[model samples]
Target: MHGPHVVVVMGVAGTGKTTVGPLVAEALGVPYAEGDAFHPPRNIAKMTAGHPLDDEDRWPWLDAIGRWAHERAGYGGVVSCSALKRAYRDRLRAAAPGVVFLHLTGDRELIGERMSQRKGHFMPETLLDSQFATLQPLAEDERGVAVDVSGSPHEIAERAVAALRAA
Candidate 1:
């Protein structure tokens, strides 16, 4: 079993990064960090306005997030983020080469429905399409595992942990 030896929970919002991450973190007995909270207020404002962030807007934040994920291996923690692009993932890899990604994949309609029901978040349901548009699905060689989100949160978390152990 590969302890990661560090990990990141990744997916578009409503795919359950926040919910799945904490459970996975607890199972591994490691600290958990939420990636959303690291976003710049300007970026939050843009997303709140129902606008998609371009790579220009994302690089700095992505770098910051990647560096933070890199640190988790030494400090011992798990991070949850959308991490929607391959280039972004590469930057993350540069920072933390051994970082394992636990990808949460769910149906577009289901994720949209959940996002629509959510409240108090900067990202809106309207942005779901944009997120999916920007999403670059991970390849098998990316050093991670994909967990289908058709089941319960606990099921997702269990599958993630199981994959992590096997990775």
Candidate 2:
């Protein structure tokens, strides 16, 4: 059998990473790991309180997620991460090479609206601006695809699966 096909469903907050990650994983017959689940308590508390995490706060979290990806390699898995910066993605790649990224994108207003309507998530609507400010779209050489998140979750997941296959 081929190695695990690890895909990171990524984007700014409220782009539907949690909703779409599992769908993509299910479609691909892989396990799904929620990115938020990997965040430490402090990180969650900080975000819950409307504070954006700095690089110092992120490296260890990213490393933990990367470790999960590494362990799941050759077995197939999907994970959701903000992966808002190229450097962050690079860290993940360093830990698990050949990890594909599915970058969900949408308009700020739409995303903000979605954030406002969501419930029980640690990330707040107030941090939406910081997320976008820190976001760096996938570079030309990155192993990923960008899928617009304007459609329903099902549609978005289907599009992401199609893009993943093509990639």
Candidate 3:
């Protein structure tokens, strides 16, 4: 059986997954999984140079992230991923049958602005549009909660924890 709940903090590049995932993990008493660490260098370079990753470039990374999510399900953990598309989310589900996603959503332009101001990130602001195009918002059947990114980081983190606790 899966542990209490595994929060997968998911969104586009600047949607606060990195910022929020650990906060939620701390609140829930679980380890934090950095999904970006699982990405291949090639993909990282492609995004670093302002090129968007296609489906082929993403599948294996998705698989790795999913496995990472499932690997510690016995104890519970939080994973941050740019799980933009439904197929990506599907692979995550296959790896961990009961993973719960906390989607951090915001306007593409706003996110791009954040990405531009950010430092040390490989994913450039130019790829923000592609990420938005690829996104498939959580469906009603998915075990997830949608948190708007228009608020403060703590607000978003609290909202995710509240949803998980309530669930």
Which candidate number would show the highest lDDT if scored against the true structure?
Answer: 2
Give all TM-scores, in the order shown. Answer: 0.94, 0.97, 0.94
Greater-lDDT candidate between 2 and 3 = 2
Better of 1 and 2 by TM-score: 2
**Best first by lDDT, ranked:** 2, 3, 1
lDDT of predicted model 3: 0.85
lDDT of 2 by residue, 1-167 (tens): 13457899899999999999999999999999999988889999999888999999999999999999999888889999999999999999999997989999999999999999998988899999999999999999998999999989999999988888877
The candidate that wins on TM-score is 2
> What TM-score would candidate 3 get against the native?
0.94
Score each candidate by Cα lDDT: 0.84, 0.93, 0.85
Off by over 4 Å in 2: 1-3
lDDT of 3 by residue, 32-73 (tens): 988889999998998888899888998999899888777877
Alpha-carbon shift of residue 91 in model 2 (angstroms): 0.4
Clashes of each: 0, 2, 0
